[model samples]
Target: MKPKTYFLCTVVFLASVAADASLSLAFDKAKLDTFLTTNACKYCDLSEADLSGRELRGADLENAKLGSVKLSGADLSALPMEKRTKRTNLESANLRGADLTNANLANAAASGAYLREADLTGADLSGADLSSANLKDANLTDAKLDGAKLDGAKFCGTVMPDGSKNDEGCAP
Candidate 1:
């Protein structure tokens, strides 16, 4: 092989390696532990963190900031009624494809959050504010939405709490 050609191939390989490195984002376990122990991490920068497929049941994240955080396939279910206190605050967070089965999100503020294809089965969202949030293709089977805000929320192909599908908010 020619020297010039070899140099070109090496440059291309290096560039690809750099791109892959930049694309990889890891979850911050220390930050998660801090939030869990203290029960307070308001405005904490956890953007673009990967927390997929983890069990974070009964986490109290009220008023915490989790913008652009990746929690796909994670279990965020709430604690039992006897051990319940404040609801988790996921306001304006990117929770696309996350699992929140049986989570007690009563009075939680999740306005304008991205929850596309998320599983919220049996979650209690009573009095919660989900206005303008994306719920496209999300499953809400048996989830409680009594007095919950849904004004301007996207529900295209979304499953309702009563096990019915709704496409009222879908755009043609």
Candidate 2:
């Protein structure tokens, strides 16, 4: 092979390896399994984990520390009645600044979660418990919140589920 062609090939190979290494460092199947089987992950750190676009239907993640976790476009929706073992748990998890756009989060237990500035546009949050969650400036445009608990939940500058903007939680 020509020297120039060999150098180009080597650079491309190095780049691909770097990409793969980064992805592998972000995802851990063992940790995921632990959360699935235990139903409890209090203070479990999953920061910067790339879980985007994953199908996590019926996953129980109650009290798991998911700070800065990338769950954008992921499916955390409820399963059918027959297939459901329990509701998904995300209660009190540090979901601050997470991207959940177009994600399905129906019936999730997310009370007291730190959802500040999270993107929830077009996401389904029907029947989810969001009581006392800090949802300040979170986008919920075209999102579904039918029967969801929003009492004491901060909504300042938040986009409502019906596409309306709210400033009730915004500071004066």
lDDT of 2 at 15: 100
Q: For residue 64, give model 2's deviation from the true position in Å.
A: 2.3
Clashes of 2: 3
TM-score of each model, in listed order: 0.63, 0.72
After superposition on all C-alphas, the RMSD of every candidate to the true structure, in Å, is: 4.8, 5.9
Query: Against the correct fold, how does model 2 do in TM-score?
Result: 0.72
User: Can you tell me which runs of candidate 1 are displaced by over 4 Å?
Assistant: 1-25, 42-87
Candidate 1: lDDT of 97? Answer: 66
Q: Candidate 2, residues 54-159: lDDT per residue as tens digits?
A: 8777666666667667888887876567655556678788787788888889888788988887888888999888999999888998999999998999878898
- Residue lDDT tens for model 1, 1-172: 9999999999999999998876664335677668657655665555466555555555555434454465545555444467554455566666676666666666767778788887888877887889988999989999889999999899999999889999998888
Sequence-dependent TM-score of model 1: 0.63
| Residue 18 local lDDT, model 2 | 99
Scanning candidate 1 in windows of ten residues, the lowest lDDT window is 59-68
True-structure lDDT of candidate 2: 0.79
Error of 1 at 110 (Å): 1.0
